[model samples]
Target: MKTTGKVWKYGDDVNTDVIFPGKYTYTIKDRAEMAKVALEDLDPEFTKSAKAGDIIVGGKNWGCGSSREQAVSCLKERGIGAIIAKGFARIYYRNCLNEGLPIIVSSEAVDAIEAGEEVTVDFDAGQIVTKKGTFPFPPYPEFVRGLIEDGGLIPHVKKSLGLS
Candidate 1:
């Protein structure tokens, strides 16, 4: 659970349509289907080849587009360990928070990191350790991080008060 993840880099303005195509979404099938089209514009093999705990690093304004919860869901289904980007679109950022995924905004780290590089992510301390150096980025709010730790806000809330 504490192992480092494999990094995969991307550029800016990666819209939701690119993550989950509008056509495929209507099926409402399993996540595996949705994941196939995830990031299709950038890399068609993303869903097929990406493994659990593999990291996604990207440039500014990442995840920019529709406010589809499916975007975050699809990534989670594909076993994305975390996302480190220079910047993130507002709605997509909130969606990731709701899903309890660790998405950090780190231009310094993003610029220095590369695909397949092993790196450590500290959600609590907001730290990132790469081969060249270590840096701290903005951490999620305490409550939000708690939700992330519990694997999404809805489940976290339910488990917190023993509602589930």
Candidate 2:
């Protein structure tokens, strides 16, 4: 799988609340509506400026707080192609995978990529390419990749059960 897009850079320790603030947690149940407010608290213009295939790069400890899955869902709903971070909170990382959001752990790429720069991620090769250089990361295992391809765990399970 490959994804290419302009980068949206973020700092370290970005929590779930900022990704999808709690203010709307109870009020918004629709995916599209939730996406409209994604990252608004952290970057007021994110929802307005981020396009369907944009990539997000972040410093260490990205997704550091709360385990709210909306954080991943909102990004996916907005059509974010993938997220690359120096490090990720354990639960958040698992959440992303569960939700079929492509997330990578790469300090080098996070440090080198600048906001607005175009980047290409090759999941099959586990590499990220930019004007700066090519950075490598570990490829996802086949099963996980399948889950992501199927649009998350639930869908993957449904397909496995011959229900989809």
Candidate topping TM-score:
2
On the 0 to 100 scale, the lDDT of residue 127 in model 1 is 86
Tens-place lDDT digits, model 2, residues 14-127: 999989998888899999998999998899888788999899999888888887888999999999999999999999888898999999999888888989999999988889
Worst 10 residues of 2 by lDDT: 139-148
- Candidate 1 regions exceeding 4 Å error are 1-3, 159-162
Candidate number of the best lDDT: 2
Residue 76 lDDT (model 1): 81
> Candidate 2 — number of clashing residue pairs?
0
Which regions of candidate 2 are displaced past 4 Å?
none
Whole-model Cα lDDT of every candidate shown, in order: 0.81, 0.91
Q: How many clashes does each candidate structure show, in the order listed? A: 0, 0
